[model samples]
Target chain A: MAQQELEPFFFRSGQEQLFGCYHAPGRGPKSAARKTAVLLVHPMDQENIRSHRAYRRLATQLSGLGYPVLRFDLYACGDSEDECELGSIHRWVEDVAAALKELQRRSGLSSICIIGMRLGATFAATAAVEHGGLRGLVLWEPVLSGALFIEDLRSAHDKMIRTFLSKPRSTTPDEAGLDIMGFPFPDRLLAEFKEMGLGQLEGSPAEDVLLLDQGTDYSALAGGLEATETRLTHKSVAGPRIWEEDPSAGLIPQEALKAIESWVAETMP
Target chain B: MGCGDNALKEQAVTFGAAAPLVGILTSPVASVSTGKAPEIGVLLLNAGLLHRIGPSRLYVKLARFLARDGFHVLRFDFSGIGDSGRRRDTLPFEKSSNQEVSEAMDHMAEQTGLKRFLLIGLCSGALVSFCAAGQDPRVVGVVCINAPGFSHIIPDSVVAQVSKRQASRYYLQVALSNPASWLKILRRRVDYLSIGRALWNATFGRLQRSKSSASTAAPDSVAATHGMQTQLENFKQRGVRSLLLFSEGDWGLDYLHCELGKSVKQLEQFGAQLEVVTSADHIFTLRQNQRELMNRIRTWCLGLS
Candidate 1:
């Protein structure tokens, strides 16, 4: 086994300073040289905590396999020096672009791969659409519909309200309108997210997209893709939903990690 | 609009003690007609990674609410966190000890001349408040909202699993490094064992009893209130009243509530009041709900005074 080393780095996005941990492989053969550097984007809210160790493990594994990996906190997240209110879809996309550029700069790698979980995946997809030179993409249960996700969050919020109120609260999404996760929703963020749909985004098309759906089916998202050269791969793993609150019950499927590693090995130039 | 007319006057101060705590003090913007002067004050705690900024809105709103209801409020950054220049780099929360918190309470008490105090802690702040309540007599009451107790209780079995994982990782790293070093590290493994124990106790000890009851189909409120009762009793021995507030949708509380009822029932048994605010997230960000919750708190604190 080779000694592994990690370097801490910071990049600026607008006025906010974002923090990242870059992991690089030790000396290796040139023929076995890794082509793509990966940027690992974490999920939002409590999901960040739940998936933290797993994300670190992913980064470690990727680096161990001779690829350079960078794991960063979104502005207002982790050790980043910005307020979370500074976290918007546009700002997050900008942050990803900035991170990708920094990853390129630090690794001196030509093409890059993005591996994002949940909301991070949404941002990666949006970024890849606008920016060129992405070698591949890996989305772990990407949020396809921001509006629907927000609606679910709102529904959860409403349920909480009802439970607290000790009265029946409206359950119908139509009646409740578009409010999720305790935050009021207009179409601003959702419209921007909807526009970045994998099928609609413009680029050389994602080289390859590996969607790791925990419980939900990704058929619709897979079927909707119009990318001429892009390959879509979907895998469902039986593990605990990392985003949910129960830590004891949910298991992080080993298959998911294996699939991810396999995909990276196959796709990397 | 003037500072004189404002219900709370804000000032920045620093303590010259070890670790040198610094914070903002907000006194009643206006004097009460009774001239009784509030004897109780509040210390606001921040959410994760937010420092004082996390609690800025809550503290401002709370300060006004409490001040109008007749209590002074102090909102300050923890050392190395927020605006405070010191960070708890090597010291974990338990080991960093409560030295900084005690100084903050002392400074607030001395400045305000308030004989009684209440702590409003969110997330990590809640843990600090718990520790502070244990150490300070001036802290007569506490309201901990959405605190995870510590990072140990995210899953019921997380502590044990994490401990095992950490031990394995440590041993594996040592084994891979050198066989002789592995033996050397094995001799000192007791220290790591103690660290694991401390981590477990710090993280899971707070939630274990309640979690066990929750798993057994016990009412969540009962279990939660029981946990609160024990915490409040610890506070009560020091003359501190306890209030445990949880929002409806907070996923953290979902499991506990399911297993515990409202926990309020248990809190009342310990002479601590528990309140549930509808539609409020962990931080009570919703404008209308925040106002309502603040009003309820004002009424409660007023009754206490």
Candidate 2:
């Protein structure tokens, strides 16, 4: 296997310049995937920070497997534009499309594979429907339903507040229209999440979809995939939940990474 | 105003000689080549294992905040953390960490032509800044928030206090006083075993002087504390400013107090400010807390010029 190169650059999404790192496949035609690439969509807030190392490793691993991968920060996230309360899921979906375009332009790949985690997966699946030509998708522990995910976040937020805080404060995240665990999770974004869910969604653009599950009920999502005549590959892998786990632990879901590498190599080709 | 009309431009850069460091430098677009250095460049180090974005993306917000204030900011992962690859060097991690931090300073100096810097970091990042400020002459100021292991060698007095504070008696008293505490314990939200072990170690760990980390007074303990104090005094002598911010609830506060010993108060005599955010946890997980922390930092930065 030839050595891969990571190119970090900023690409435009409307007026916003989003940060992205493209993992270009190694030298030699034997190692490079000439016409196919992967775009990584990160989870929201702390999940984005937590899963960063995983996604970077995944991108490098995928690039090593002959597919160019681009891991990017969505607008108002990571190293991107520093706007507070960037409150629009619809806008993020558009940013995903823009990332795809950037990935295509950078790698000169016509076919794209989007690998999204948690809420990022929800965004990818949503983006796939609006923008065509996505060859495959790997949804790793995707947010099955936005409403449920919000509830989970709410409960998690409440638990964190209760456990860590001694003197109660006035600002409740659910009440204040803001988030605490990094960037602001605006009320508008929370409202948009009410309409998100893989099962509730009408269609999926990608023909082949890989679901790496971490114990979420995917029956309804599977049914939707079946209805769409999508080539579905479901893998149940148990490991550290990198999306929430502390980064210092140096935890990587090796099983998931390997599963993705094998599944993508087999499914995409 | 958040990231005002300064026309901020950010570029991902790779620096360092053998083991390259990856970082994002956010700057006002118009001021890069003006031949006049900005007042100071802020370097945001990694908070624990959370990469350069800091815990809860604190560094990102801070970088933008400082950039809006006309300060060039570089937020980057050290050698092996975040997006940066590990060094294949023979030097130990501590040595490498120190070297790479200096390398970041060099990179910032080259890009912005700024000789002075204000290093801001949380947790391990805080410790890095603490060490860097002592060593690097370019570091004009430091904002160390919740630095764990500020001093590797724990003093006996701190150990005694930690033992007394974290003792089983303390836990028993608290558990007896609050029904909610017991309820949380019942729900497994509070790990009894871990707490039990921690309390046991804290209480009895010092008794076993040979095995106890607090007891073995390494010859360097005096040197380390003195070195740290000397560094702060050096900053004071040189008119360098510093802000030592901490969360009252964080163990790092105790650690900081322990590390500084008596001279912690003398920092204020040298125009350094020490503050505690009563509502914040170690990471400032609350949005309100984050805002307060940022506001405090901004206020401190504004005072610089």
Candidate 3:
């Protein structure tokens, strides 16, 4: 097995810095798939923490198959510079653009693609739409609507209060925004999430698109994708929602990973 | 407002043999404290499976807060937990964590010219800090937040329902006391099997109240408490100061009382302090609680002789 050279660094994303982990493939017979470099945009908030191990594994796995991969923490998220209060959907979208640019600079390859999960996919889609010319895109259970996503989070918070916080509080959750799960959901970000959705997006972001859904219907997202030369592959895998699962090493859905690996191999070949 | 805005500079670093671990080193633009020793460093540990930034980025907030007060801080993921690669050698976490933590101190010393260090952690991280601080004499102080009893886990065959040794959960007491929980139970929303297990745990007595763990093989509750006492005594004899902070709603605080009823006095006798936050859960899920916890930590660090 070839060694994977893992490098952690902070690079300039606008005025601040964003945390990035690069997985470079060692010298070996490269994978048969296209020479396009891959960039992974991760989910935010608690979903980001829960899916971190899985993302790392996915990056490692892709690198092992001879593709250089970059996974990054957007500004105000993870080890990146700035605070959560400083985070915004607009800024996060720019972070995605910056990350894609960084990935391009690091790989020195013309053909490029992206794999984004949850809201990460939404960000990737939004970025691809704005920037254009992605060779391919993989959206694994992408959050189609930011409003509905926030709704799910609000629902989760209600359940959390019922289980852990039995006593009544001096202030209601709605009174001062919400501190869902553990991280604070700033009111500005909440408003951003409510107003932002893929429904508001127009045009296809990539020439080749793969939508991987599990226990959700997001077919409507690509329904109006209007790229004449584009190809869209839709598939589903058997697995529970990983975002809700307690994070541990190797708790990732392997079947879903395999589906991705297979689709990557078949899509561009 | 949370952290890492202006006063502190964060540098990504790697340490340990072969530089296998990844950490963020936070240093203030200028040291702001004149009351305490200025050369002291603070090391933060991973909470449960959480990475370096910590749950809700609590470690980040605390690190930035302490850095503003003129202290160097480093928060890193344990081997195999975050950006850090897996350890090449196969040592279980309980045994390897202490060495990793000790190595963190060594790395801090070698990197920053700091001699004395302080360790901070939450839950399992808290337990590791307690154990590792005992091993390292250079450690001047230790902060343990919501630490569970280091007792072994009772197997499922022996005691199924008491696997967590936690009371804050909604199944047993939380449900029985709260009218809303009763409503949930009456609505058949709560699982019958869980209620049965809770009843069995309740009827079986100390098994639930004692050290409940996830492992099939851990020390008995009494033995674990004894182990903690030995470490507490070790701190006293070595003149190491300690702070055991707990939230009023966490199972860890309840476990502390259950295992050692008068042990709070023992803790005080040995220069170990206990501060329980009234408005927080185990993770201090609320921002106000995090502020209080951070305040307690800063005060304790400043007061360290």
**Maximum-DockQ candidate:** 2
Better of 1 and 3 by TM-score: 3
Per-residue lDDT of model 1, residues A158-248, tens digit only: 5444333222233333322333432333445456545544445545437788888888877777765434467877788876666654322
List TM-score per model, in order.
Answer: 0.52, 0.87, 0.88
TM-score of chain A of each: 0.80, 0.91, 0.90
Q: How accurate is candidate 2 locally (lDDT)?
A: 0.76
lDDT of candidate 3 over A1-269, digit per residue (tens): 11225887888888898888998854456554447888998888778888888888888788877788899987878888876767888888899899998998998876778899998998998999899999999989988777888889878766655555324243255444566766667788889988888766666688898888887876576575644355888888988678888674448888778888777766654
lDDT of 3 at A102: 94
TM-score of 2: 0.87
Q: Compose the digit string of candidate 2's lDDT tens values, residues B1-305.
A: 11323457788888876565778998876654344435788899888778787777778877876776677899988876777766766887667777888888888888888888888889888888877777778888888898775554556765564454444444643444567887897888987786777577557754653344445445555666676677677878878888889886566766655556555677788767889998677788776788789999988987885
Clashing pairs in 3: B152-B218, B152-B219
TM-score of each candidate's B chain against the true B chain:
0.68, 0.78, 0.81
Ranked candidates (TM-score, high to low):
3, 2, 1
Best by TM-score, which number?
3
Off by over 4 Å in 2: A1-5, A28-34, A165-168, A173-176, A180-182, B1-6, B29-38, B152-224
Better of 2 and 3 by DockQ: 2
